[model samples]
Target: MVDVMHQEVVALENRRRLYTGLAVVLLIAVVMSGYHEASQLNSGGFLQGLAKFFDYPAQIVAQSWEDGWAFWALFPKFLPALIETLNIAAVATIIGALIATVLSLLSSRNLEVPAAMIPVVRRIMDVMRAFPELIIALFLIFVLGASPVPAAIAVAFHTSGALGKLFSEVNENIDVKPLEGLKATGSTWLQRVRFGVLPQVLPNYSSYFLLRFEINVRASAILGFVGAGGIGSELSRAIGWGAGNEIAALFLLLFLSIVAIDQLSSYLRRHFVGAESFG
Candidate 1:
C-alpha cells in the first residue's frame, strides 16, 4: 500500500510538471507575438501613445462637464436624436428577425435540403456575417446615399447576418423527438417544420433576436461615421465641431439608453422563454 501511494504521488507530480512546462511555453509564444506586433506599430513610442489616450479624453471630458448639471440640461436637445436611434434599432431588429427566421431554416445543417445547394447557401451566409457592421454601413451609405435610410439599411443587413447565424444555432439545439413524432404523423416537410421545429426553437430564437437588437442599438450609433444618419452621425458631428460638452451629453445619453434597452430586452426574453414574466 505504501509503494502504491508513492507511485500515485510520482505520477501526479509528473502531470503537474508537464502542465507547467506547456503553460510557460504558451505564455512565451503569446508574449513574443504581442512584442512583434507592438514593434511593428512603433512600440518604442508606446509611452507617448498611452499619454495621449488618457490626456486627450481627460482634457475633453473635464472642460465639457464643467458643471454636472450642464450634461443633464442638454438632454432635451439630444432627446429627438435618441428617439431616432431607438427607432432605427427597433425597425432593424423586427425586420431582420423576420427575414432571419426564413434564412435560418434554410441554413440549418440538421434540416433536410438538396445536397447540391447546401454548400452554396452556407457560404453566402458566411460571407454576409464575416463583413463587419461598419463596412456594411459604408456600403449602404454609397448605395442609398446619406440619410436615416442608409443607416437603417446598414443596421438591417447587420442584424440579418448576425441573427440568421444565431437562429441557425437555436434550430440546431432543438429536441429531436418532436421532429420524429411529426414525421410519424405522415406530415409533409412543411407541416413538420411548422409544427415540430418552430415550437421548440421559438424560445431560444426570441432570445437571440432580442440580444441582437441590443447590439444593433449600439452599432447604429456609430453608423454616422460612415454617413448613415442616426445618433452616431450627430455624435460624430459634435466631436468634429469641438463641442465637447455636447459629446459629453451624448455619452451620458448613450450609456443610459443602452442600459435601459438591455434591461428591457433581458426581461422580455426571460418572460418569452417561460423563465419569468414581467412584474
Candidate 2:
C-alpha cells in the first residue's frame, strides 16, 4: 500500500511539472510572436529606436547646461502653471474622495442600506473605472474647450471609481458591532454609516485619498498637453518649439513636484495610518 501511494504522489508531481513546463513554453511563444509583430508594424525596429532614445535627452541636457541661468529663471516663469496643475489635482482628489466614500458605503455588502442596489452601484463604478482619464479629458475638452475645468472633472470621475473599489474593500473588513449598536439606538442608515462606519475607515480612506491626489497631479499635467490647461500645455509648447532649455526646466519642475508630493504623502500616510498601511 505504501509503495502504491508513493507511486501515485510521484505521478501527480510529474503531471504538475509537465503542465507548468507547457504553460511556460506557451507564454514565451506568445511574447516572442507579439514582439515580432510589433516590430514589423513599427517603422523603426525596437533596437534601432532604443539606440537613439537618449539622443533627445542628451541634446536637452547640453543646451540646458549652456543656458543654465535661463533654465533656472524658467522656474519662476512656470511657477504659476505648476500651481494651476496642483489646484486641478487637489480639487479632483477632494471631489473624487467624497463621491467614493458615498459609493463605497452603498456598495459594501455589510453596510449597504439597500442591498439590492449593490450590484448596480458596483457596475457603475466599473464603467467609470474602465474609461481612462485622458480619454475623458479629450471628450470633455471637445465640449468645454481648452480649460482646467474639464481636466479637473475628468480626473475626479476616474478617481471616484478607483477609490470606490478600494474603499469598498476596506468597508468589508470593518467590525459590524458598532453598526449594530448604532442601529439598535434607532439611528438612521446615514447616521449609522457616518457615526459607526466612517470612524473606523477614515484612516484608510485618507491614506488612499492622499495617494490618489499624488496620481491626479501627474494626470492633470498630462491632460494639459491636450489643451486641458496646466504645466503640461507649457511643456508641450516647449517641445513643439524644440526649446531644449525650456523643456529641461519643465521636466525638472515636474520631477521635483512629484517627488515632493510623494514624500509628503508617504509621511502623512505613515503617521496617520501606521507604517504597514503606507503602501
Whole-model lDDT per candidate: 0.81, 0.94
TM-score for candidate 2, residues paired by index: 0.91
lDDT of 1 by residue, 99-166 (tens): 77877888877777576676676666677678777887777777778877777776777677778878
| C-alpha TM-scores of all predictions | 0.79, 0.91
Per-residue error (Å), model 2, residue 187: 2.0
Highest lDDT: give the candidate number.
2
Worst 10 residues of 2 by lDDT: 270-279
Q: Alpha-carbon error at 145 in model 1, in Å?
A: 1.1
